[model samples]
Target: MYAVIRVRGRTGIKKNIADNLNMLNLTRISHATVIPETPSYDGMLQKGKDYITWGEISEDTLKELISVRGRLPGDKRVTDEYVKENTDYDSVDALATAIFNQETTMKDAGLKPIFRLNPPRKGYEGTKKPYTEGGSLGYRSENINELIEKMI
Candidate 1:
């Protein structure tokens, strides 16, 4: 799965990008959402590329994210036994693997689709430019996990 994090806010954003962000369910700063890796999602990410950063999420990071930020229905924390009883997966990693493979989504696992995160402790270099330009937008591949860790 891919993790998409909103880098910028909703001021001065164009209509199309705003709509794309809404479809991605990222209306707040420091919010994140996991989506399957597919052509449709690829286009959505690109549509909001200027306002977000995305990348392939690692299994370890997925586990950490779920343990720390994942919330069940009614805002409960996700526990190992809860995952086992509520879903077929035995562990967070297994569920993450399944989601990574597009067998299930965050919804299927009984977890909240949106992850509310803290702004990176050190702050971003710039939200106006791409990752390759020493900024915080666009794709960062495995480095996205590093960013998530800081925010978590």
Candidate 2:
């Protein structure tokens, strides 16, 4: 799965970019959502790259995210038993492994589409440039999980 995060605030954003962000469910700054790596998602990410950062997430990070942010239909937190009862997985780690393997998505496991992350504890370098230049926008590859950890 891929993790798409809103790096910049919403203001003066073009209509198309805004639309893509809305579709991705990243409607607020510091918000994130896990998405499957499909062609449609790739296009949306590309179109909104200037305002967001995305990349593959690690199993460890995925587990923490699910434990801390995963919510049920009625806005209840997911427990191990809930995961076992609702999905095929016996535990969160098993579910997380499947997500990393692209065998399942957050939606499949009953997670909320959006993750309201805390701003990175130490703050981001900046949000204007690409990740290659030490800014927060654009893709960060597997390192995206590291950034997510700081925010979590």
The numbered model that scores best in TM-score is 1
Model 1 residue pairs with clashes? none
Predicted structure 2: lDDT: 0.88
lDDT by residue (tens digit), candidate 2, 1-152: 89888989889999988988999999999999888889988988989999999999877898899788777788898888998999999998888788778798778778787888999988988989999998989989998998999998
Q: Give the TM-score of candidate 1.
A: 0.93
Clashing residue pairs in candidate 2, if any?
none
Worst lDDT window (10 residues) for model 1?
92-101
Q: lDDT, candidate 1, residue 137?
A: 98
lDDT to native, each model: 0.90, 0.88
TM per candidate:
0.93, 0.91
* Model 1: per-residue Cα lDDT over 69-105, one tens digit each: 9888898988889989989999877887787777888
**Which residue ranges in model 1 land beyond 4 Å of their true spot?**
none
lDDT of 1: 0.90
